[model samples]
Target chain A: MKNLTLALAATIGFLHADPLPSWNKSDSKQSIISFVDKVTDAGSPDYVAPAHRIATFDNDGTLWSEQPMYFQAYYIFDRIKQLAPEHPEWKEKEPFASVLKGDLNSALAGGEKALLEMAMATHANITEDEFSKSVADWLATTKHPKTGIAYTDMVFQPMLELINYLRLNDFKVFIVSGGGIDFVRVFSESAYGIPPERVIGSSIKAKFEIRDGKPVVIKTPEIDLIDDKVGKPVGIHRYIGSRPIFAAGNSDGDYQMLQYTSAGEGPRFGLIVHHTDADREFAYDRDSHVGQLNKALDDSKTQNWTIVDMKKDWKIIYPEYIESTPSQ
Target chain B: MKNLTLALAATIGFLHADPLPSWNKSDSKQSIISFVDKVTDAGSPDYVAPAHRIATFDNDGTLWSEQPMYFQAYYIFDRIKQLAPEHPEWKEKEPFASVLKGDLNSALAGGEKALLEMAMATHANITEDEFSKSVADWLATTKHPKTGIAYTDMVFQPMLELINYLRLNDFKVFIVSGGGIDFVRVFSESAYGIPPERVIGSSIKAKFEIRDGKPVVIKTPEIDLIDDKVGKPVGIHRYIGSRPIFAAGNSDGDYQMLQYTSAGEGPRFGLIVHHTDADREFAYDRDSHVGQLNKALDDSKTQNWTIVDMKKDWKIIYPEYIESTPSQ
Candidate 1:
């Protein structure tokens, strides 16, 4: 009878313990567990096939930091500085001039209009292959301004474990963001273990042709697709064909994605990662400049979507400090 | 001296006998073995990461027979006849009139131009979900005209084995074809073990909106994308965002796919399935009305792509028959 009592206590302790030791079981962590459990429990009639199990995550804030300015915007700024000698005219351009002068705040002060101009100038005219190479090269050397770590390493450790866990269970995980597809494709494999092909994001218009006896596709300035908000569902339908059973996001931009995924028939899961830990991480939601998480919070309560309090659930923020070697 | 003589005689007898028991070891089979050896052997410099391994295959000829007409065309014809009662005007229309009168040859005599009309009439206006269900219903009952076997059973067995082998090796295989995405998505899983999300194909326009307090994306008649021939590479780039490392095709329409895949700066593999067994299956290429293989044949020689001789490499065509199943 004593042995049975001890065994039951041990089982209860294991069940309550963090299933993912790599993750810090904060509020964000709890939300992920609750959502995954509801969708993955076969006994509850919510079990999904390994094939139908798909989870799409927004990258910038949902997976990593997108503080004062977007991470891609910083990448674009650096790229402009590096390519300034090649295109002297950029020094005199409106947004480019501001960016070159080290005034990103003023450059993007005009909001979407200025951002579009900067994006178009930097991203256009190059072959898609060249753009991919450039992004890869930049990511290899560039470090985040605050963390002093490579931008790639700044990804949330808990989120990375969630991604791997979902994949282990046969879920086809994808990164769907408003960021350029080429930019994210570079380090997605090394950082998130999500292959380049599985990452679907924004894209520039491109044309396929044979040049110098070699086939090449060139990225043009014309906006082909913007994968955000309503565009998320459209892009998902266009690329993935089937509706995802699970979705995770940290901003209002992801509301539609969660809605589309949760509204589907059969088992479904939706989660919103609320950045509530200011000391360990940035904490801004309703009135934040980047990655606003207000509308989603209201929707979370009404729609019964799991809301993740980042500070409470996560025991650690990044994987690097957890072990001596970062790669593991 | 007598014992040595006996040993030499035994060695000679062993050499005279065929080494491979089940396989015929024809040129086509040898090519497959050589390619798989180079890619899979870790000792070889050509070894690739399972994650980076991507293989794309054309559908109509590579997977199944597209003889008298594309099997989907036959399905559309049957669909038109079945759905004709709802629309009395379809009986009076030119293409529909010819289709209803059982003069399929005359109706499709105009070729692609006539086929487009039939496709548009049969596939438009319904919600994407409704259209998918319709396709599923059709496939459940549809049988091939010649062998009286279900069309799904007509899928080539050896090719199916290749798909499974590639997947086992961590290759992310995709089906890039000109077929309607919805139609192919219906039966691709049961036939090829490829889920709907991995199948990238031609698409009609769709619009997303809230209907009856719920979000729904509706399909439209306007052709949005065509994934065939030159368009195959474009579709692959748009949907997958990564160049495939290996490609397989059976016709000229897949030429660009092979070209785009093989053109990547790495060890690449390209194979063309050449139909040469008229006794067991239909064997028309080059000048064939459907699934022309001329351009691919010409490029295969120029580009040094492997050509798979159906009669030589495959002991069995379809999976249903065990008598002709290849041993290895």
Candidate 2:
């Protein structure tokens, strides 16, 4: 009788327990659970090999917040300000002039042309080690404009839980993004449990050389590769070789990656996060200047890719007390 | 007295015992030994953290023979011949025409431009899976023109032992090659014990889509990314962001990779394989059209990189016939 009563209590506890407590049970949550259940249940004929269990996530909006402007862009802006004393000429430079004026809108008004100028000026002429240190220093102190939180702290806790859950099920997760390679690598391990090597992103040219009896590599202004849109699939093929079986994205920029991942043989999953709750978090998707999600939405129904409703799926947004405590 | 005799016998056996009996230690053998010893010995100051134990090898000359053109090109030539009847236009195509006419020199006369055309015609319009199968089928029957041995059989036994040795010491060994991604993926695992996903190489475009209620990806004629020369470091950064602590190469093309590997913080090893024995194997460098060693030789001296004198360290070149043959 004692054993039967203990077994009953255990069963009741298991039934009431939330599988993904860190994530609020929303439509996004349901989609994740349904997809994971479908793929993980061996008895249901959806079991996948550990080798084939590859999951790719977009870095910016999908994994963290990319509102107002990209967090890395802000990091670059702060970097320019910090280095301003050494290079007084940057005060008179066009984009740098606007940047110093605190008018990022006008500074980036020229789009790719202006952004390239800013990137070249800030990312070049330094040894990779120096660039890494500069980035680390900037990220350590930089805060998001609206939330008054550290840029790193703005990451969605639900996504963090999702990453952990996928990894627990033998999934090899990779960050495929358009962000700078070194920039993402700085915090990927601590924040996402993804080591620097597994993070694939845009890159600038680097030169090999020896300095002070030790070999060193210096970053060059020349753009080596752009890992975005069509480049995503190309990057995945070049770096990863095998197509991913699962992909998560929050914008149209990740469409190709999701397409490539879902197009592979056997069980596959493609998920798109829809930011529709303004009270809990900022809400803007289709027409958002940063991470536009329009084209992906149009194809979501046709492709049968899962659309995660942020408001319905998530019980919480960022981690508890994230607004008070910086992520770094 | 009996115990002393037993101890003497044990010492004699230890002195005579070959640790890697399956490997015919050649000139490149000693460098491999020195590298492994430095990196793997816990007592050595050169000991590296398991995470820092990243090693990369060039596929063609470093891992296997690339003489008479890269083996993958030979595989493509054979593929074109096998598929000749199905594609009538191939008969009149410039490179394909020369290839079909058995004029190897003329087919590759235009270098990468001509090679790209030949590759596109031969590889396009097939699903990625189908292309993999085609490569697997070709490798099974294809033999090296010089040795008349299976292409897989031409891999240096010493290098094979080195790969296993490094892997056993917790080193993450990766193949960063200039060969076609699909071409290398077919045999990398069976030949080198490297899974296809870990192989980074040049690639053509591929498309993902669902067909017949199942996901499938199709290879396209578009040139995606080429993994060669300076492109090697770019590929490495994009795929494996961590700077490798050890790099092995046989040509000037590998100079940048070696430089990049050795440029990382902490202990590193860079080795260049010098082909100097015409008796045991083909010997040509500096002026050689393929695998030029001139630039690398100068850089190796200037950068303090170790150069492997193949003639001195190796006891044998290829695996012994008896060793390679199947057990009775």
Candidate 3:
């Protein structure tokens, strides 16, 4: 009788518990909950089958924090620095020289061509294992410039709760990012509970080769898919095949993905994480060089996409804050 | 009391049941079972985590019959015939002219270039929905020229059982096909119990477009990925991210994938389905127009890969036979 009573109490507690605990009681939170509820409810007209309940999230800003610059850019810069002694030509090169001088803006000034050159030099001409290990090592040792926190710890607490909530409702959540596919894959599973296969992102060409009687996949300098802007939806179609019912992103990079998600027939949801909290997290939009939220932010209103104001909607910024703060 | 008895009996039956009932008692069957058992056993040194237990199967000859020609090729020819009225110039075009004359060999004589022309002409320049609907319609109406069986029905029953068996043992099954990614995605779920997202294959470039206020993905003529030969490993890396522990294929196309899978530092299993039964199924190896099993066949001896001789290993071929032959 005691066991039965305890089981009942546990069930009730679970039923009443807030899934997104880090999310403040705001319209953004309410909209997300309502959409999930309606779609998951079998009796509702907006009901979605579990098989079709795919939720894709943009990585850099949507799931985690991308401030000052993308975390991947830091990785690239660091990688260039590490390999600087070997490549003497890089000291005088446009992007590499700028990167070494700690002038990120000047490095980026050379545009996509320079970025691709650096990405290829650092990311390619090595086995997939070696590249993965290097990324993993860098992430383990690297810290954000201003926050002084480990790069992985900078992930949004509210977004983590949202991902958990989605998964609990049988939604297969995926990270569709502009970041390197291989780079994100290393930490996706450990950080977000998303397996490597579930993470889709920009990639360079790679080929299989036999080295010392063992097969190894070598990353090539050639650019393959660029999972950004217009390429987001293309990546979704190529990787996922099926259209996602729900999509979340930050900045104009996510515009096409949200557009594609909302365009699908039946009840669909699109979410945008608008960084509005300057004190808690970095706040720059419209004119921000990295993760600029201009066209997506403006169009969110017309598209009926739920715009998440970080200051008002999220009670907590990072998971570290939750551990530090005492519960009432 | 009766319900309890039935439940206990069901549990016992499940524990002892032959997962691959279609597979005859052979070395091939034993090897597969042994590998799965060793890897799944918690106390065993070779035990693999469920997360890493990925199994990839080649779609065409590995999962279904690709005899006479690939089933997708048939779809292409039929599509060309249906669209011929719209393209009068196809009457004089080299490949198209041969296709119109019902000469498949001549149509294919132009090789990959000719095939791409026909594929793009029929397969592209339409919305994804239209293309999927057409594939569905074709499969529903069409029958194999030789066996008069529906294309989907031509799937090997033993392979189906093997896929199910792996899934039962906590393996995530994926279809890595040389066929068009979009083409295989249509029936992947229904035919092979593999979801669209889990199916990786050759693809054409597509872009998201808002046509008449509705968002639609339009397939373009541009080829994006060719998931064959060395391309197989590249596709696997790009999509799966992690190397599969278990890999199955029937042709040289899968050679690289198997090589990659086996080279991984773990207990791995590679399977080659040798179409050695001309009476039951078409037998062509070393030299075949489609799904040529040459180098892989020769190297299998050294690779320790289990080669399934169709005649000796499979008790039943297609699922239709199982229905016709009633259990004693």
Tell me the TM-score of each prediction against the true structure.
Answer: 0.89, 0.82, 0.93
Candidate 3, residues A57-113, lDDT tens digits: the string is: 999988888888789888999999999999999889788899999998899998777
lDDT of 1 by residue, B195-225 (tens): 8878888888766667778776677788777
What would the DockQ be for model 3?
A: 0.71
TM-score, model 2 to reference:
0.82
Candidate 1 residue lDDT tens string, A50-75 = 77888899898888878767889988
C-alpha DockQ of every model: 0.46, 0.31, 0.71
Kindly list the per-residue Cα lDDT of model 3 for residues B18-98, writing each as its tens digit: 777777778889899989999999999999999999999999999999998899999999999999999999999889999
All candidates: interface RMSD: 1.5, 3.9, 1.2
Q: Measured with DockQ on alpha carbons, how good is candidate 2?
A: 0.31
Candidates by DockQ, descending order: 3, 1, 2
> How far does residue B47 in candidate 3 sit from its true spot (Å)?
1.7
Chain B TM-score by candidate, in order shown: 0.88, 0.87, 0.93
Which portions of model 1 miss their true places by more than 4 Å? A1-13, A22-31, A34-41, A322-328, B1-24, B322-328
Best by lDDT: 3
Which residue pairs of candidate 1 clash? Answer: A24-A314, A24-A315, A25-A313, A26-A312, A26-A313, A26-A314, A27-A312, A27-A313
